[model samples]
Target: MTDFITRFAPSPTGPLHLGHAYSAILAHDMARAANGQFLLRIEDTDLQRSKPEWDALIRQDLTWLGLHWDGPVLRQSMQLTSYDTYLAQLAARDLLYPCSCSRADIRAALTAPQEGHPHEVYPGTCKQRLMSDRKPGDALRLHLDRALALLTDDFPRFVETGEAHKGTHQIDPSQAHTQIGDVVLSRKGEDIVAYFLASAIDDARQDITHVIRGEDLFDFTAIQVILLTLLNLPVPTYHHHRLIRDDHGKRLAKRDDARAIATYRAEGKTPADIRAMIGL
Candidate 1:
């Protein structure tokens, strides 16, 4: 509990489930334990999926769990300008390029059957495209190769305090090249910010000392660290907590309405019950 400035940032695309409860409670409890700050951020950057009702429901669910924050909630939609400002910074260093590849286009670009995760590594379809060539309906992608080359020193290793990956971890240059190819910064057809860029900027802006999130996001952290380093922002310690899974051992998702916090509340479950359920 040396540094406990953490946040519970949930996308307002759907309902908050038991998984959300565990993350929110864990962050809140950690901050309280250290007499530190806990912040809430509504990650409603997916304009197409984000809804006002879902945002309201998220607040309601967290409140019912008895969690409190130090200051007002910060919504990412209002921080569009900040995202743009940072994107421009990357562009200034020639570390960004315009990409026009759709999912289908990217798949077609691959010469072989790629395994593991979909969009695991971009085929670099639009790497040749320049900023001046950017047009509507094109995504802005990070030139990861250039970005890594821009690093003056070794990629920063971050400290993890969560049950999973609880140690110091560093990123290897070779792994980034073959696996995490140029990731999209802004979406096609608009200036919509992607998760890594927006979250990095928000964390810096909030002065967040630690990032507490699910291990599902553990792999992509290197990209965020890369972005933070290039932008010359302080990188925080990351704690990738274990995921709350269903009876089948599959991790919970928002679609699991049965596990939604609201559903449990309707069935008369208390906050303490939730703590026991998630093995707090």
Candidate 2:
């Protein structure tokens, strides 16, 4: 059997909150219980929003939680060259196109009858457009149709772990073609690397066997699976756990300063208290 390798990838955009603690503990506990390896990945993909102080705080917070990773911490910000290599490969296959559409323009375009997937769907406005016509500020997007064709031409079926995914999950070529339209692989700001693309590449490079994250990102699994197929990378088993909500039952956000782990720690809340508070 393959050794289990799991990761707790947290973005260093803000201080670690209760939600972050829950995820870190869960991933660490799972790894410990199975004698598996627990890895820490700093997902500071958005360089503009990510801060050095926040990164330091993340290390401190996790250490306070008594969780230790097996390997040196991996930071996504340092892997731009790797992302560029993958981008070039996709572009060479004609599976990527430059998109000049702004967020407002996309929303306007989607105002009409929605034809494809629901969550953050990107209509194929620039899928077939010539690259020369795109402005310098345009974002790079993956041509879903081309990606699907490539996947279907190679591996026609994919099955995800039933234990982690609730049941065996298969990706039909036709469904992937329709549901996952063109998605943004990179944007203009800060050298053009986006979360979806960077994350997919990093996960493969890290040799992660399992991805345990919040359930809020469950819908995003489809797009990641598609990217893995296009890149010919092995897809990891995914476990989307329940989120830590606020007093109003809303999902915790970084802006919720009162719920920040630092605040909880300052209030003399023990790690055991944190585990109980989050029902770990």
Candidate 3:
């Protein structure tokens, strides 16, 4: 909480729900309490679903909640070239390989339980394949093994402030592979950059010192830490707060129109009512 700089980044694919409001309010209040900066980042990397109208709606929603940001909003769509530069660097170092595996192929490969937690770990079918020999429909994947190998004496670490996992934790190679497999750095064709890659880069680029988001993203943070280490970026302290859930204990989704902030606003629910509802 010392000179903290946090962000409330939301993808413009859908309406802002109660969970979104809690995260935004938490980040904004934390920054305010510490006399630091709070930022807004539009994670619209998924071109097909993201809409400019949705972006505007997100702004309106946050403003209604009285969570004003410190500066102009940072859009991920505008930083594709910057992301490409980082991807090129990884490719040059031979830390990335072309993956031609389709979703069905990946599913089938993951079906055969070899080791680990039997989760969907990439079977590394295309690890040995070179990018030069790959076809036009290939996607780029981070060679996690190679990336970890490069970090020799300089071990990657991150500070976690969440209730579930707290303290300084050093990222272990075996655990990284077991928990999160070789993640795709880029997609098959358009909007090649993956969420993990782009968001990590964006966080570092914006000088984010603290990442305040929902606890659901807690697992994926280790992967982002790995990417930040490889790219020589500043690793921020993460505060994964509790998620807003429904009566049945299900996380709120964009399709949950009943829990959407806009819907609540139309129903005459105040921002104070929102804070009380989310246990803020």
Q: Report every candidate's CA lDDT.
A: 0.82, 0.75, 0.83
The clash numbers for all candidates, in the given order, read 1, 0, 0
Per-residue error for 200 in candidate 3, Å, reads 0.5
Q: Give the number of colliding residue pairs in candidate 3.
A: 0
Where in model 3 is the C-alpha error above 4 Å? 103-119
Clashes of 2: 0
Q: Across residues 80-159, which tens digit of lDDT does each residue of candidate 1 receive? A: 77788788899999999988767455323221112233446777778988999988777788998899887747776777
Clashing pairs in 3: none
Q: Which RMSD values do the candidates have, in order? A: 3.9, 4.4, 4.1
Spell out the clash pairs found in candidate 2.
Answer: none
- Preferred candidate (lDDT higher): 1 or 2: 1
Residue pairs in steric clash, candidate 1?
137-189
Candidate 2, residue 41: how far the Cα is off, in Å = 0.8
Q: What is the lDDT of candidate 1?
A: 0.82
Model 3's lDDT to the true fold?
0.83
